[model samples]
Target: MSSLSEIITSSLQKYNDRPAIWVDDCVYTYGDLSYYINQIRNVLHQQLTSPALKGERICIWAYRSIDAYVGILSGVLSGMPYVPLNPRFPDERNLSIINRVRPKAIIVDKNCEDAASKILPTIKFPLLVFFPSYTQKPKWCSLIKQHQFFSQEELISYPLASISNLEVGSVVNTDSSDMLYILFTSGSTGEPKGVVVSHGNVFSYVNGINTISDCHYDDRYLQHIDLTFDLSAHDMYCSWCSGASLYVTPHNLILFPNRFISEYKINKCMLVPSTAGVIQGHNLLFPNSMPSLKYTFFCGEPLTGSVVNGWQKSAPSSIIYNVYGPTEATIAFTYYKCTGDSVDRCLPIGKPLINQQVIITSSSETAADEIGEILLGGSQVALGYWENEKMTDEKFYSHSGKRWYKTGDLGKLDPNSQDIIFLGRSDRQIKVRGFRVELGEIESVIRKIAKTYFVAVLGDSDSEYENVLGGEGYLNVVALVANSQESKENIIEECKKILPDYMVPSQVIFLKEFPRNSNDKIDYKEITKIYYKNKNSSSISAHNNVI
Candidate 1:
């Protein structure tokens, strides 16, 4: 299909009664989902009479809900791009995105109405659509009565029933090159940068993965990731386009992923490695706990062997894949199938996806088994950062007549296996005493020795106290470990055995948990704050002798 609207409409006709989405205690059939889409499309039309709204961005407060899904699909169906603002984000961050995109309208579900209400007034003449949940209302629901509210029951009854009778086409035919959505990633310039992805970019990705994987009509795919994360785009569209069911994990059960999978009998899933690590850290995996799980796809972070091995032992029938890609290259374009017995105890990110090309570049040449910046050339590489020409020109470049996105990640092809082994981010590489160090390499060694999935190694040799601590800088390696049984000194000694003296962490800190950010990944900034606060403490000084 050329457009997601076409994909949805086609699925509606084919699987009319089949369950399309399962959230909480509700199961919405394809017909039910399509009906709501039509009603929402009509609702959007009634409110968005301004022709200027067409082709502009419509920001949606994305969360786990039937309305949240319909709102995005509906906006795309209305021939406008959608910007998903996670309700969990701070008002300032959301406001920054709003100001940057300058969306014509905003859509919010009941869970986010309070947050959206406070933000909507900041924009001029902004049209708002509020989708109230059948289960509950926001705490401030009673205070605001002027906004338009559409509940599931209200959308299915009376005037909406008439909406079904009206010969209106829900699918709006736009050029496949049109921007479908813009997802903002943390920018190096303090302000977030919006990654512009066209319908063609996503269409190629969904079709490419489906062609190789077992994502078919019979599978019930789980949607546990937050919608704002680009991985959710893969979760929703991949399952929907294949006519499979998409199950949203309950907020209460997100922390307990094993239960979510077993209870839902999910056959397919895609999630970050950290979520799996959480399950492994808790020893939550029981024998055959998730027998129904078939295809397990992991991305957004490095997939470690111990985590996947433990997971593999529990779900013996499943095939675990390590999928890797950046937001600029659509959801993910590289595919790596983990065999559980991977060398170096870490899974290779593997080759490129179908209709995509992966090359490692150093200086002016691309070669195998060479450590260099990874470049992606394919249909999946994005249009560039939204409205930022200078930034776009810097990352997205035309090489040999094909547009290639320069993934700042450092990786090299295995001379023997030809698979890509990701090193780490090129920009994140730091120098210690004139020696280059990759934080991920240190974290990798920590994960292997600690037998734990969550590990973060932070260091900076250019701090103010550098003159006193060491030659250039402090040269301090602060290893933040989670759920590891090894003592701080033992962990430091283990690193000293395998890693060089300079690479060994000057201090090792143990925590029951590592603080996580909005993306549910380890919050390095928070850890940095804690690190600095304790840098001068006597307790840390006692452990400095280990270095």
Candidate 2:
């Protein structure tokens, strides 16, 4: 059996009667969860005739409910890899994914029939849509007469005793290097890429976290991340493996985090930087709230200096950690505890996690203090991007008998503390005239001077440049999005004092809020789309000449 299933099965034996899941007002014990999982496993076995179904991929479409958790566990016990599709995805994208993965079957909630029916015509495989007895039936289900759908009561009536008799091994064997899940990344440029994570990779990460955080069976995890994102894996598997209780918050209560955390009694939680920013923004609302919150981790985007300061001020007693990793690295490979001193500047992403190694590599060999691309070599690195060998080969490479995933992020090692200080992305570094410029650096300076809520620096590539350069035609552009009333004049004045002529932003556009992607990160592609659309229509031109 794979380590994942073994861990869960062992936990169930120890904590059989303990409350395993709490969603809304419903509570499910470990015994109940185990029974439901076995029942669903029996249903899958009865429905499929092929002996090779053990390794086949299955797709699950459901909301954040106890039934969804049972469905995931059933997939694991039945030796099948599972993929979770968010209910919020549009019909076109959902259909595209179904066509791409070609899963043998799809398990969906009956409440989503209206949205599901829009994409049902595109799905060619068999399906088992589920309807819980607790919720009201959707009106659209009455129209679908051809497809097979099951209700909670009817499904439970099937003999689960037969399922208990069948021998079920783990979905992931030790030697089998197959993908356990395919999480689709938010596609800003075009179609999203499916990040394939193997069982070994996930196990390595979970084990590391367990050791570092001292996670135990008594830990009560508050799940805030969506199941589609990799961060959710920490809450799902970590809690399940340790025999801990998991509380899934309703989607509506997510934005108003104070209420969600208080009502759910969330002791431990993970959040994106954007959500953290909002929570910290309203610090006065919950001055004494988060007493039960023992561990809080933030990722999914860079945590700015201002945001960190706010969190520290609000949740003074909680242990705040800043974790860094891409989706390709199984959520996080390195983490930094936000000490009182780390807030003075940008917090350093501390040393690598267990079984992980990070190296700063430049064009030429250099000392430890040199700045370069942060290359990650570890057990947590994913297999590769699914089905795109050319793009996969470019990013994933072998070095020194170890496979390294080249993180496009730039960083420099601190000489005194030996921690990694994050710089901006290498691709984001632009050359204006003859001077090299880092947009993040400029944004940092502007943030300090303007004291804005958020800031984003965008390069305008299509600007006209005729006589700005000395006989050379260099385009003039600008930075956009700063949040403050004094931002326009304050940013210009600050830049003139500290920055050279070429480094100063040619234009600064203030806005109420910046556009963000589904993952809660800044949507640069959408910003570019808006920039071009507005540039063509506007007549007022502001260009800084660099000699």
Which predicted model would earn the best TM-score? Answer: 1
Task: State TM-scores per candidate.
Answer: 0.76, 0.75
- Can you write out model 1's per-residue Cα lDDT over 16-49, one digit (the tens) per residue? 8998999867999888876677766665666665
User: Which consecutive 10 residues in model 1 have the weakest lDDT in total?
Assistant: 465-474
Poorly placed runs, candidate 1 (over 4 Å): 49-53, 132-170, 363-367, 429-538, 541-547
Where does candidate 2 clash, by residue pair? none
lDDT of 2 by residue, 165-217 (tens): 44333232333255667877633223556777877787888888876786877
Each prediction's total of clashing residue pairs, residues at least 3 apart in sequence or on different chains, is: 0, 0
Output the lDDT of residue 7, model 1: 82
What Cα-based lDDT does every candidate model obtain? 0.73, 0.66
